[model samples]
Target: MEFKNGKITKGFAFLDTYELTVLMKAKKTSKAMKNTMEETQGYLGMWVTEDGYIRHELLPNNRYDEDRGKRESAYQGRYKVTGNHIEYIDDTGFTADGDFVDEKTLHHGGYIFHKKLE
Candidate 1:
């Protein structure tokens, strides 16, 4: 059983039944604090942050059908882009390289990265 929105929402029972629900709440964000959060499009992607992070793709959408074997990965790791080159250091201690074709596209580890859209 559980409480939702400060009230009991559901429950179930058996031959010998006991149930307890805890209602927890978080302080509501102030209007000013809420406005600050809207300043960043955080969900767009981590590309906004300079510190390197790995974004991996498993199945190809449309542009990656030819590289299905490359999409197979038992391990993955972080990446860094310098100039036109992007380097990937896999978790297994293997270093590989690729190229960034454009600002919104990167070809790395036999996979492609594009600016994701909602």
Candidate 2:
């Protein structure tokens, strides 16, 4: 960096290929984080199977709680939704994913879910 008259004259740093790639990846990750935060709001609520067996709740803080049968909190995890695709990482290290068929419908693990009405 060079400075003249108390102002920056040359302030750019040239990066190597690996450094540039890392920087780009960091930028992309930041953008994806922002998008996930925004998109999660629209998906925050309870989604359930028709028989009410599986109850999945997407909380405001990007964490989820799922109840199966009579088991409350059968699964608890953090989740990220990119576009209409959702990925889950359970507290016990189990992983799963799902897709939104529409605004109110989700399909995961060979089961279909609908947004539960309040």
Candidate 3:
């Protein structure tokens, strides 16, 4: 923020040309971040059960089985999502990655997860 003669001239607004200089500069960075979403219900529950229920669980936090519910071992890993790319880090420090093939399809671990009912 800045103070000028009888005006509340601030960081976002510039009195030099009465322009929003700061917001314009940050727009590019904001646009990049906007392309990524975190833990949306659709993405969080990608896996479906045999009974046609979407397993709304967080990845990297638990090892879950469609038949056996959640177990104490396997596939517990943290994940990072940016744009269409996903990175995974498991409990054993193993790292993997995948990309979104489409809005309803994810290509991960050599498997194609589809949003279709199975």
Q: Which candidate tops lDDT? A: 2
1 or 2, greater by lDDT: 2
What is the per-residue lDDT of model 3 for residues 1-118, given as tens digits with 9 covering 90 to 100?
7779967777674365435677776898887555543434345544533343333234444332222245333456577777678777766788877776555676666655555433
> Residue 68 deviation, candidate 2, in Å?
0.7
Lowest lDDT sum, 10 consecutive residues, model 3, at: 60-69
Please identify model 3 stretches exceeding 4 Å from their true place. Answer: 1-42, 48-73, 116-118
In angstroms, give how far residue 98 of model 3 lies from its true place: 0.5
**Residues 24-115, model 2: lDDT tens digits:** 99999997655532365567899999999999999988899999999999999999888888899999999999988776898988899999
| CA lDDT for candidate 2 | 0.87
C-alpha lDDT of candidate 3 relative to the true structure: 0.55
Q: Per-residue error at 82 for model 2, in Å?
A: 0.3
Deviation in Å, model 1, residue 39 alpha carbon = 21
Q: Candidate 3 — number of clashing residue pairs?
A: 2
What local lDDT does model 2 show for residue 35?
59
Q: Compare candidates 2 and 3 on TM-score and give the better one.
A: 2
Model 1 / residue 47 / CA error / Å:
9.7
TM-scores for all predictions: 0.34, 0.66, 0.45
